[model samples]
Target: MVFEVIGPIFLLLALGYLSVRLNLLNKEQVGTIGGFVIKIALPALFFQSLSSKDLHQIWYPGYFFVYTSVTFLLFGIAYWLMSTHFKNTMSQSAVLSLGAGMSNTGLIGTAVLSLLIGQKAMTYTSLVVIIESVLLIPTVLILVQLGMQQKANVAEIVKKTAFTLFKNPLFAGVMLGIIFAIFQIRLPHQISHVLLMLGQTASPLALFAIGGGIVGMSLKYVNAQSFYLVFSSNLVMPLLVYLGLRYFTDVSQEMLHAGTIIASLPMPTIFAILGQAYGLNEKTLTPLLMSTILGFIVSGTLISIWWA
Candidate 1:
């Protein structure tokens, strides 16, 4: 059953890697696939997962409070290091923020936890995605932009920041799903079925895209210091957080596994996109790719053992 669950995910990643190797897809095409996963597939997954769970049955708000608190704290410390010690530009700081804290809560977290912890945990995973996609990304990006240029107009910054969450499909999906869940609206069976089919595509698709996207990166630029910084987030940070959760929090074994995996998820491809948009692509892309690819393998192994 576990292999049945994990098989398609690895298959899709293999397909994506193969697609890149065969020159069947270019960087832009791979990126479009990522956008599709975020916009269409992942949102469907969230809506389907969230809408099915009774709001009353889901876990406490305090769980999210703790989760968000931990995320932001880690991000804050990392950002300070990048900004002050590293003398990083705003965009680079933003990338570090993402690398340190943004977890793969939606695609990988959902599927893996469902297999290990049962379907009930999907709600928790979905909520994590909500926090990351809707709240964290925008907040961190605003800081990044500000760090890059501190003299920008406050009002303009507010306007652009407010629009950030709405512009992303994954965020849209999370908000819409939460709204429906909050209102206790029932979808028609046909609509739910359609969503189930589409939402099924998200996990493997994302993994595949990760594999292909790694092709765009050049490991040559990776330095000892950059490697260490990225490693802190991808490896050590998760281990520290996991140990803390194991001792301090009253979270489930499943949640512990989930939290660790989320912590260890590859630097979001969104970081790469943001970097490119801001012309910091070359500076940040290598570390992002190296950490992500290595993080995927390391974290996936850890999750497998922890869940097992």
Candidate 2:
């Protein structure tokens, strides 16, 4: 059953990889596609996911608090440790922390959990997606901005952060989705059908962007330390989340497992996105690439075993 659900996603990503390798798409084009997903497709999907659920079925407030809190705690500790040895600049450290800490919740997360837990339990996972996209990613980006500049006041920072959050297409989508979810208003039948059709494009577009970005990247920059860094984020974070939550909380097994799955998943290409956006060195892309490739393999194996 798990394979049945995951197979299409695997094929979609594979197609994306092939498309890039064959020079069918360039990085800019891929990024544009990513923009489309973030702006149009993903938000539509978010709305659909949020609206489809019965609010009573989800422990939204509790899960949101717990998952977001734990995410920051684990990620903060990991970032501090990595910064000490790597000696990354504050902004670079912030970007790396975000890249390493944030999971690809949109691409792999929704698909994997939907298969493993079904639609009912999906709201829990959706909450994770919301936290990462709407909260964690933005907070980290703001920190990177402050860390890099080393000069912004709280008011300036808040002002800039608000602008970025509201102006960003992806974040905007999430906000719209939440608003609709809160109002308990469904899109009319025709609009709902349209959203469903458009929303379906998000996963493929996101995965393809990942692949396209991967095609031009080289592995030569990856070294022992970089590999270790990636491994620590990819492997250690998940284990920490899993073990920490397992013994600490009485949350449902599904939610517990959701934490582990997210923790275990690969870093998003957003690491590179923020890095490039802020003029951080492209060298960071090495670990980002390597970590993503390795993380995908590890996650697949781990989830397959867990599913079995």
Candidate 3:
């Protein structure tokens, strides 16, 4: 079962790596493809995933509340550790925190969950995406801006973050899907079909783009700090979630499993994009992402097996 789940994922990643190494695709083309996967395909997938579900049936506030809380808690801890122990600058620490806290749920989580747990799991995963995009992302961006000394005051930081987030297509997609689900609105068959077609491309393209992106980056910059952050993300966060849900909360078994698996996913691909936007050190962030992605395969499979 583990191989059945992980084999295809790594194969696509290997293909992406070879594509870049062999000059079949350059970095610029990979960037364009990655951007499309993020802005277009992912949003469509989020919309279709959420809109197709009955919100009342699948909406579990306890799950959302617990997962979001744990996510932010891990972010805060990571930021503190990097800032104090590693002596990283605040901006650097913020980016590292993001790497540790944010899971690649859009790509990795969706694919794994859909395969292991089925379509209902996608609805739960969408909720995770919404929390990350809506709350955690903006908070981290504000910290990044503050760390970079770009915004002078809290108000300015909040305003800029809000503006940027609203412009994000992924967030827009989730909101629209939630609205549709709440209203019980059924999209026209043609429109739904088009979205389905685009959405279908999200998982495979996203995985491939991740591989291509990794190949385009150099790993020479990896250091002890990078490994620490990767471990925090891939192992520590998920372990906490699994234990907490099992012992502390009344969340369903399915939700408990979903939370653990999603938490175990690698850093989101967008972390690199945000690092660039916020003037983070790419040398460090790139390796951190790459290592985390590679690490999650092992960690995720173990969690899946244990949870099963």
Candidate 4:
């Protein structure tokens, strides 16, 4: 039964890698697939999913508090380690800290939770996306900008980051969906069906893109830092979220489970992008690869223990 949910996910990923390996799809074509998922399919999925949910059904104060607080706290810890212990440049530290603190919740988390828990997965997924879009990513950008540009203005950076998030296709879709849900405005059936069709393509394509991306990663980048990142992302962060919510909040059992599973997702593809742009290419790639493999293993085990 567990494999019924898990098997197809891995097979698609493997097939994607195999396609690239056999030259059936080159890296450029794989990148095109990723772009399609990020710019089009995911936005549609988030919009369609959240648009159908009531504000109350998706909004859980306790869940948000625990998730945001714990993730930010972990990010802080990673930042401190990089800046103090490793003595990396501020930009480098900020880039590495992203891997430690964040997850690929949009693509990987959404795929897994929707399959494991059914329709309500979208509600939890949107909630996490809100935290990431509104709070987490902006905070990372603020620090990264500060580090990269010594003369940068704090307020200006904050403002620009906020504007960027608002303009982001993913964020725009989510915010639009939330607005429609809050106001109970239903789109015409044809439009909604169009969105649903696009959304249904998101998961498979996302997983395939990830696998193809992994083929380009090299083993030379695997180091202690990679282990640290995978440990933090694939294990420590999720464990902390689960413990904090389990002992401290009145959130339901399923909510607790869902939150942990989301937390356990791998470092996002964006982490590697930011790293390469800022000159931490190998550092980001190794752990991004490691975390994906281990993240699935850990999340899969959690699901089996709870549901199987």
Worst 10 residues of 4 by lDDT: 216-225
> What would the TM-scores of all predictions be?
0.88, 0.86, 0.90, 0.96
Cα lDDT computed for each candidate against the true fold: 0.72, 0.69, 0.78, 0.86
lDDT of 1 by residue, 33-148 (tens): 87787789878877777777667655556557667777777778777887788787766786666667666676666655665666565677776777787678878767766766
> Considering summed lDDT, which 10 consecutive residues are worst modelled in model 3?
283-292
Candidates 2 and 3 compared: the better one by TM-score is 3
Q: Which residue pairs clash in candidate 3?
A: none
Which residue segments of model 3 deviate by more than 4 Å? 286-290, 303-308
Error in Å for residue 61 of model 3: 1.4
C-alpha displacement of 50 in model 2, angstroms? 0.9
lDDT against true structure, model 2: 0.69
lDDT computed for candidate 3:
0.78
Q: By the lDDT metric, which is better: model 3 or model 4?
A: 4
**lDDT of model 4 at position 66:** 89
User: What global local distance difference test value does model 4 have?
Assistant: 0.86
Off by over 4 Å in 1: 1-8, 114-118, 148-150
Candidate 4 lDDT, 197-224, residue by residue in tens: 9988988898898888888787567776
Best candidate (score: TM-score): 4
